[model samples]
Structure formats: structure tokens, C-alpha cells
Target chain A: MNKAAASNIYDILDDLPLDSGQVLTGAQIAYETYGELAADRSNAVLICHALTGDQYVASNHPITGKPGWWERMVGPGKPIDTDCHHVICANVIGSCMGSTGPASEASDGAAYAMRFPVITIRDMVRGLMALLDGLKIERLHTVVGGSMGGMQALSLAANWPERAERVLVIASTARHSAQNIAFHEVGRQAIMADPAWADGDYYASGASPDNGLAVARMAAHITYLSEEGLTEKFGRRLQNRKSKSFGFDADFQVESYLRYQGSGFTQRFDANSYLYITRAMDYFDLAEEHGGKLANAFHGTSARFCLVSFDTDWLYPTAESRHIVHALNAAGAKVSFVELSAPNGHDSFLLEHEQLDRVVQGFVE
Target chain B: MNKAAASNIYDILDDLPLDSGQVLTGAQIAYETYGELAADRSNAVLICHALTGDQYVASNHPITGKPGWWERMVGPGKPIDTDCHHVICANVIGSCMGSTGPASEASDGAAYAMRFPVITIRDMVRGLMALLDGLKIERLHTVVGGSMGGMQALSLAANWPERAERVLVIASTARHSAQNIAFHEVGRQAIMADPAWADGDYYASGASPDNGLAVARMAAHITYLSEEGLTEKFGRRLQNRKSKSFGFDADFQVESYLRYQGSGFTQRFDANSYLYITRAMDYFDLAEEHGGKLANAFHGTSARFCLVSFDTDWLYPTAESRHIVHALNAAGAKVSFVELSAPNGHDSFLLEHEQLDRVVQGFVE
Candidate 1:
């Protein structure tokens, strides 16, 4: 996309709703579309990302050399079948990328900084709805995501039940468990603790709080895998030597992996976006929207739901997905639940697996 | 109890072997003795510690304003009652406390720093042998520990099977899992990345890697507890606030908890010590020391072994304890295994619980 087209999303900000008790207004959301929109826009599929993922779900990251976060499941001829489905992957509000968030210009044209209103997951979905309106999409064929993205899929199904005919949530929970919120809190604190974070006014600060962000990533990365996975992959082996020099060094392979994860994450991600996104995720509670009853969220909703969970994903776990399934069943909503066997934990949804691919393709189609 | 008597242990180190082949041995090992050493030293009980735990297992931490790490399970009226068993809790080798570790002085009377050797669980046991000889403790009633300390207990039994009559391994594994090592590596890199580390010679420069050490502790601390424990203690609830500031601050209770844990840890703990201890833990592998035969680690052992694991402890779960139990059973050893219910995860052994307490009390008795 050219800078003019990308910047067009910024210029049209005034057309979108800025306030509804949401912490921020004039929020900019960035997105990308793949495949052609079918006549009537009925073939459109919306893809939501996890806390750190953005609109580049099927493309190479501009800064990092790593592949798109969800390329395994969203590429052409892949699960979501770009050949048959018009896929839309949008950067959620309160995130960096091309999206308008705390780092984006306010009405007066200054970066929102700490002044950005805290956006909720529902607010993000609202922003996405506006984006869809801008794209002239009346209704989506499906809404799909894993982890935090999965949460969004459910939120879209609950708050705007008619937006999609099918909703596929992978490795996600309907509500942010107290444990989930606690872990996210640790990551946010790590980023904020960076001497350079400058109270979320980091854009003009030149250098970001890379160290804190790195630590936060390292901490979150641990929650994304199973203990068995860690054992099989990097069991306490030394780094580049047989003997330890005994000083502060990456003595074990696991420590080295975490450091690499943390350090590499700083390249493409924004610290403020991280803080904002995590807060939004933490504040998300679908059950709270429907008289504190989870089943009520799906009450009378015609959207067909498919919730996928990896057996090893203790962070969200199969149980959390089952909770959603149980709620859906209680509401008598059409939904299918599968606990896919995967050793990769919560990250399993992002990786390439024949079973996961088959499941996503069948569900979305 | 007096300083003069404690200083005598330092003089005896000269008679011990110095550094050789991946082991550090140029300094003294700090320790505490409870109950009287019976005649012939037949009642001696050697207690070990986890990665960060020190010889102050049943004493006060000088900096944190807290009691010993395992005081709940080791003091008077506790499970490992000092009123009955003669307990010897020693700071392991590769530790900062008076232990002969990398942080210890070399023969040149300067901190070994990076020159400290890569020491293993067996090597730590070897250092203990020297301490035992100096104290003239010929035989033991039991050897006990949780996590890393448990590894040392197992190592003692494996290396000198006849010396220990009973062994209690709690929340531990015989081998380092890949994930375990990976987490440690992340922490080490966090410390090393700090300019204050000064290539691990921060000791001479008087500018220690406090930030790195704090970050490392923050990461490792998360693994030491179960999600249930963290959620129970610190949920998404903000610290004395009803709403998030949307800035880089302690917006949630967990962030404040982690920050406190990180900053408070830097006070008494040395950065180099954190590096050395974690490295030792990473090098620990019972089977590797016994000519690659995992069962050989306990070959011909007559010691009664009890391995206790917590169901929520992913770090070293019941499966890991069962792995050790299977090997012990295969070796024709008297071994019992118990999978306890605890919300504390890997750190359950240190918590005040009748289940773990009863197991240790009965096994030791």
C-alpha cells in the first residue's frame, strides 16, 4: 500500500466515533486486505491478532526479518484460503503499525501519548467495525483468531452478533482469567520500567524502553509453551561452552532463547502499543457485557462458532475454551469445540500443522 | 551461633581441593547447624536449596526483611523439625554466600568473577564432601531438599549412596528440562546485557549488574509459582486504584509485585551469584554423572527415597518426579512417590502445608 492510501485512514479519523466513554478518541486503526471482495461482500473474512501481532498477518515484518505472525494459517492455498475468501487483517486500536493509537496524531495533531483513552477489546471491535464500514463491507463471512485474537472473535460475535456468519476462535478464552491479566501485567510493567519509556510519551523520546520490553517478551514467551516443549527443545544446556565462566552470562540455552525473543521483539513493536494493547486485553471480559452471564453473550446469536484449543496451551488451555463452549451450548448457539493435540502450547495456533490447517479451512469454508 | 566459631569454617577450606575441571573450590561454604551432632555423627541431616535459596534456609535474610526461604518447613514445630533431626543447611557451591563459587575469591584474593568454573550438582556434592570431612560428619540420618536442593540430595545419594540413610526430594527433577535451562539463559542474558555487568568483572569495577539481576529474578520468580498462586495473590486488581492511568506505571497489582520482587532482590543478592547458581542448576543431570546411565545414578543404593511433587508444578511436575521414581524402582531401591495438591506450583515445598509437611516428617522420622 502507498503512503497516501495508508495515510488516508488517518485523515478519515474524524468520521469514526472518538468517544463513548472510551479512554481515547480519534483512534487510528491500520489494516490490510487479501483476495478480492466478492459481489455483496459476503465472502469477507476478518482476522484479528494477538497482543503483539498486527495487520501484517500474512506478510514479512518491515523491521524484523521474521515471517508474519499468522502466515502459516492465512497464506494463499492455506487454511483461510486466500483464493476463495477475501481476508481482512486489521491492526487493532491501541496498537502501533499503521493504526491510530496512542502513538498516532490527536485531533490537534500531536501524538496521543499518555492522553490516549484506554481502549477496550470491544472498543477495538468497534473500531474494526468502522474500518469495515469504510471498506463497504456489510457483513463478514467469518471472524477468526487465536489467543487474544480469539478473544476478539468472541467479542465480535457477542457485541455485534450479525457482523459475521461464522466465528473461529483458537487457543482463546472468553474472559481474561485473573491469571492471564496478572501475566500481562508483568509484561506491561517490564516495558514501563524501562528508563526510556517516559510515561508512554516514548515517540519523541528517541529510544524506547527496549530492555523492559525485552524482559516483558521473555516473560510472556514462557507462558506460550508447555514444560515438555521446553525440555525437548533447550534443556539446561550451556551456551557456546562446556563450562560456565560463573559471571552473568547466558549459561543455559533457554535463557538465551528468551533474550533473543525479548531483544528481537523491540525491532517492530511499539512500547506504548504494547502497554495499551495489554491493558485492553486485561480489561476485556465478555461475560461482564451480558449481565455477568457468559451464556447470555451468545444468546439468540445465529453465528456458528468453532472454538479450537491446543492440549498443551496451559496459558489459555483447553479448559478455558471448553468454558466458552459450555456457555455457547447453554445459550443453544451452534458451535463446535476441538482440543487439538499440540506440544507448542498457546503458540500452536500460529504454527503450521496439518490438523490445524484442516480444522481452520473446514470451519471458515 | 557466634561469629568467632563461624569464622573457623573458612580456615578449613585451605585443606580442600582447589578448582579442577569445571568446579570452583577456592573459598569456604557458608552453613548452619541445628540440633547437636550425635556421637559418630550418625544423626547428621544435610539440607539443600533451590537455585536462588542460600544457606539461610532457616535464618533471616539480611536484606529482604524476611525469614529464611524454607523456614516454614524447617524450624521448630515445622515439618523438618530441628528439635528432632540434626539439620545442616549449607549454601551450595557456585553460590555467593561463603560458598566456594565464582563469586568467591581466587587464590589471588580477588573475586573469581567469570573465572569461576562451571559446576554441576555432583560437583556441588563433592564440595559438600569436603565440608562434611571438615565437620567430621561420617554418616547422615537423611539428606533433603526441594528443587535444586533436591537435586543435590539426589546427587549425594548417587555419588555416595552409603552416606545417606534417607533422601527426600521435593518439587525437583533428576534432569534439567530444556525449558528450565531456557528460562535461566534469558535471565543470564538480561544481566549480561547490562553495561554495569562490565563483562562479568563488575566486582572489581564496583558497578554490579543490579538491573540485570533484578530482571533475572523477576523472570525466574514467575516460574516458581503456579498461575493459581499468582492469581490468588495478585489479580488484575490495581494497587490502591480503581482505574488504570494508561501510562507506564504499576497499573496492576502484579506489576507492583514483580517490581517489588525485582528491586528487593537486588539488595542482598549479588548479580554474579545469580549467574553462578542458575548455571549450576542448568548443569545438573543425575544420569549424566553416572556414565550416561540414568538408573546408575542410584545403582546399589540402599537409601530410602521419597520424591514429592505438586500437581501444578510445571517446572518439575508430577511427571518429572515419576520419571525419577520409575528409575529408582527399576534400580531396586526403596522409593515412594507422592503427587501432592498445591496451588503454589514448584515452590509448594516452601509453603506452610500439612501435606508436604507430613510427608517430610514421616519420611525423616
Candidate 2:
């Protein structure tokens, strides 16, 4: 488990086919790994990330200079114990962090930007499959992800059934709901409305649609946490003042927090990547791809499925997880579904939870 | 009861004091009335509008060329029946529809724009009070409103308890929670981030921040409807297409509907007014103005209170209504609370509902 050796980037020169009827050539995928691949390659676990997450799963994020997003659950003695399992986390295609995305350079040495092909959840999974192929990993011990990551796990399980033995999807859905598409559309519009976006070619101008991206992040961030969580964390409490500002400044703690989150995100993420990734998420519909019957997506799957949902995660409610479980059941797949109690909303998957830890540990073992 | 005479503007030359310690001079309020005012003024019912709603009430909106937002429940024989009682609806101050707002001209013959004073829900209610004074109304038989309008009703009953005989607040809260403020902050950020906003002075340039405002509307519109409503109405339906376009165009029906709502809003609504009104809603806290005790706000008020909430209205859930009812009960006030079943979310108040119609009829009677 050498940290330096575990984290690296791989170049896939093969022309990757896209759902948009285009091909992505000379694509690069940034990834990080923990522990060591067992001789039989039977102990490798692939962990997919959420919309704003990257390949820094169990390690320090190079850009943010902070611990990985899921550091609490995926370190040395953590539930995703690196000591017992070799964990592979990749920055999905259509993302900013060193992966082949809108910000990535094209074969002609230009940033793909708007020229990047529209990708789907299945396309992202295909990228992961390519990375797996390069690493010569025959199969994954477990494919685990939450939120968008859950979508990727579900996509991998459905499209490449033999790629994984166990599929653990947490706080995710088989398809994007109307409300989901609506919110993502809002984010995309916000980004595109920015003049600085310059039709996604801002890299040459040294300016980014930071303001628009910030607003988009702010909107998306609200959906990640529950109302109760926000109420408890910030409420209508004033920020650095005794009374209301009665102006446009961030007066409330929640406003300040959201502003900070929004601005802070622009520094580390690309706005065009935000557009591309969100579009992929919006286009996710495993059931539609499999003939409008969710069960058909898993018609010949041999993977055991584990679905977890937080009771307060309104973004991907327990009902969504239940829907996936129903599909697995109809497909005659071995599956376990649980609606865990968590006040943190859709972000419960990344937060510390003893029960979730126990479940992840037991399932992975 | 002449439609032409009922819809008109009232100008108050006197300086209107605001909660921000600022004054708004030469303020104008646009209003509409249904039916004839009783000689004794005992049959007058003040109907407040939510954010984005205007004084059109039971008549046609001059701009949108559509029926009044709540026409379904405010007609001759409908709930809040014009035949039995005179109804007054006013576009609150800081709004655009013929009202004194950011879009209104200042004393120096320039648009107030960002120079307009930041207002609160209380400030809006104060303007209504001025309108009532101009009309020579002593006491309204009922002060009724939903959403932001509910905040106005609560403000009126709390600050000027003797002005109304009854108060009906629907799907609203006594205060804006952290989540509420967060959403408003997102919308504001979206509007302000648009380069076309040009620091709220886009009017003279003939280029408005329609794109930014549209995004704001889209985001806010999502909160107005329930997930169930969205799913039922649109689901994963495409917009006049057989399958996904695999591009960023409005691929989903929900996206198309939201885009239409957003763009259509720009033609009739002022973006700066949206910023001001949402700010007012964000600043709403009845208890804060009432010495931190919610019950104190209703102290000695003779107005019978009626609070209605829809079960699916997550924006302002039943719990918020229950909180207000508890305060009324503690104040020894006559209060009726009901959480009705509706899949329409917070916008249920403006939609057709027989139960809501009956409730309004019984309460007004």
C-alpha cells in the first residue's frame, strides 16, 4: 500500500464509443488505489464517486489539499479498510479532475470543452471498465458508490454484469426522476448563462464561469442536505453580526455557508465539467436503455446487490433505493436493501455511521 | 363591480417607512377588487398574493393576458365569493406590476434599480395598510394569503391586529428557515451572476438578465411543486421527441416546461423586483419582531386564525403550520388548522381544490 505508487493516471489510446454517436480518442483517466491487488485479483474493490467528487477516495485531494471526501469511511482501519482490501477510485469521464472530460485536451491539443461528446452513466462505467482492462483486473470484489456513484455502480452491474461480484449502491436510483432532471437543468442553465463561460472555451482566456458555477453549486448543494440538517446547522442565525444586514450580503449563516461552498467549488472544479457530468446524470435511465423494464437491465446478472438509503435523503429517497431493490428481486438477483435512519439527507453515504460501516464491512467481506 | 374600475393604482405621496430604516416616497400600489364594498365596510376581504403574484386577483392580468392566478376559487360563486363579499387584492410594494418597486422611477426620474431600499415582509404589509387607509377601510372582514402572502397576513395581524376580523394563512411559516434562505440565496446568486444583470441597471441598456432570471425562476419553480406532482405530470417523458437528443437541449419534458416557465417569466416580471421580494421573504420572522415569543405576536388579537397546509407541500410543510397554530393556541386566540391532502406542493393554494374551496367558504362565512 505505497501511497506514491497507488495513485497515478492511465492513458487509454483506444477510441472510446460514446452514446452521442461519437468516439473519444486518446482519453486519460486519473485514479487512486489503496492496499495491494491480491495475486488472484479477487480482493479489488472499485469505489465510484458522486457528482462533485473525484478520484481522491482514500487519499489527500491534490487540488483541495484536504482529506478525501469519504475519508471517514475508507482509510487504514475504516469500514473500507485499505489493510484488507485494494480499493480503486477513478475520476469519472466528463469530470474535471484529470479525467478525460470537457477540460481534457483533445488529440489536436485543444481542450475538449463543448466539443466533448455527451456521455451517459453507462459511458462513465465504460471508462471504468477500460481502466479495469488496462489494470488486468478480471473482476471486482465489490463495486461501491453513492449518489452518482451509485448510478455508475448500477450501470456497471447492468451493462457489464461479469465485471463485479458484489454491487453495493447507496442512496442512488436506477434512473433520473423528473425532479432530478429539473434541478440539473437549472444548474446547467446557470453555468451557460455566464458570459465568462464563453461557450465553454474560457481556458484560453484565463477566465472561468466561476460565478455561474458557484450559483450552480449552491443550488445543487441544497439538494444534498435535508431541511432539518440545514435548520440544525445554521437556521436563520446571523453571520458575524448581531442583527439582519437588510441588504444583499450574506446575512444568514446558511447564506454564508452556501456562498462559501459555491465560491470554494469554483476554484477546484471546472464549470464545463459541471455541465457535462450533470447532463450525464440527467440522461441516466437504465430501465429505458433496457426496454423500459428495470428488471431487464439485470436479466443475466450474477452479482449480489446491496442497496442502502437514508430515510432523510430526499434527493435519492428510500423509495428510489426500494425501486432498485424491486428490480433486482424481479430479475432473480440476490439483493439486500435497507433504509437507514440518518438526518444528513442524501449525504449520509459519505458521513460517519456505525450501522453503515458495519453493513459495508460485512458486505465487502 | 366593474372590471375596469376594480383594477387600478393608488399613489401615496407620503413617505412609506421600511423595516430597513429607510423611507420610500411617492409609493404606488396596484390593486384589484371584486364585488361592491359594503356601506359598513364589514364585508371587505383583503386577499394577499404570494411572491410573483400581482393584484390581478380575480381578473385578467394585463401583461400575461391570462385569468387571475386564483380565479378558480375567487369568482362570483367560488370560495371568497365576490357575490357575498368584497375582495381586495394588491401587488405588494417592492413588486413590479404597476407597483412602486426596483422597476419604478425614483424622485430624480431614474429607475430605483438597486438603489431601492431592502424591504421585509412587514414593509410589504405596511404598504397594504396604507392602501387600506387610502380606501377608507376601517376593518377587513378577512385577511387571507398563501405562501409569501401568508407572511404578509401574519405580519398584518401581528403588527396591526385590529385591522382584520379574521386571518387565513396557507402553506406558510411565521419565519423563513435556513433552508428557505438558502434557496433564496441561490436564486439571488443566479440572477446577480448574469453579466447582463449589469448591477441591476440592465433596463436602459435594453438587455436584461433574462437568462439569469430564467434560471432563478426555474430553480424556485421546482420548490413550488412536489416531486410527486412533477413525476406524475412529466416523469421521464421527452419533449416532442422520440428519444433522448443526447445533447444539452431540453431533452426531458420537465426541462422544457421549466425552461418555458423561466423564459415566459422574463417577459412579464422584473428581475430586480424578484431579488427584492425574495429578500423580503428571506427576512420574514414574525417572532423576531414580537420579542422572540411567537405567541406574543398574536397577543390580544381578536382575529380568528385559519391555517391550511397541504400534506405534499414540503416547501412550507404541515409542521410549519402546526407551529403557527401552537402559537395561536398559546395566545388564547381562536385558531383552526388543517393539513389537506394535495399532490401539488406549495402551489396548491392557487390550484383548484374542492376541499380548499369549502374551507375558504366556511371560514369567510
Cα error, residue B65 of model 2, in Å, equals 0.7
Q: Count the backbone clashes (under 3 Å) in each candidate.
A: 14, 0
The total of clashing pairs for model 2 equals 0
- Per-residue C-alpha lDDT of model 2 across residues B1-365, encoded as one tens digit per residue: 01122358898868999888999999988898899898888999999999999898888888768999999878788888899899999988888888789988888988889999999999999999999999999899999999998999999999999999999999999999999889889999999998889999977788888998999999999999999999999998999999888778998999999999999998888899999999999988899998999999999999999999999998999999999999999999999999999989999998888899899999998
TM-score of chain B taken alone, candidate 2: 0.97
Which tens-of-lDDT digit does each residue in B40-135 have in candidate 1?
A: 677788998877777777777655657988788776767777777778887776676666666667888877777776666776787787788778
Clashing pairs in model 2, backbone N/Cα/C closer than 3 A: none
Scored by CA lDDT, what does every candidate get? Answer: 0.78, 0.90
Which tens-of-lDDT digit does each residue in A195-237 have in candidate 2? Answer: 9999989988888899999999999999999999999999889
Model 2 DockQ vs. reference? 0.87
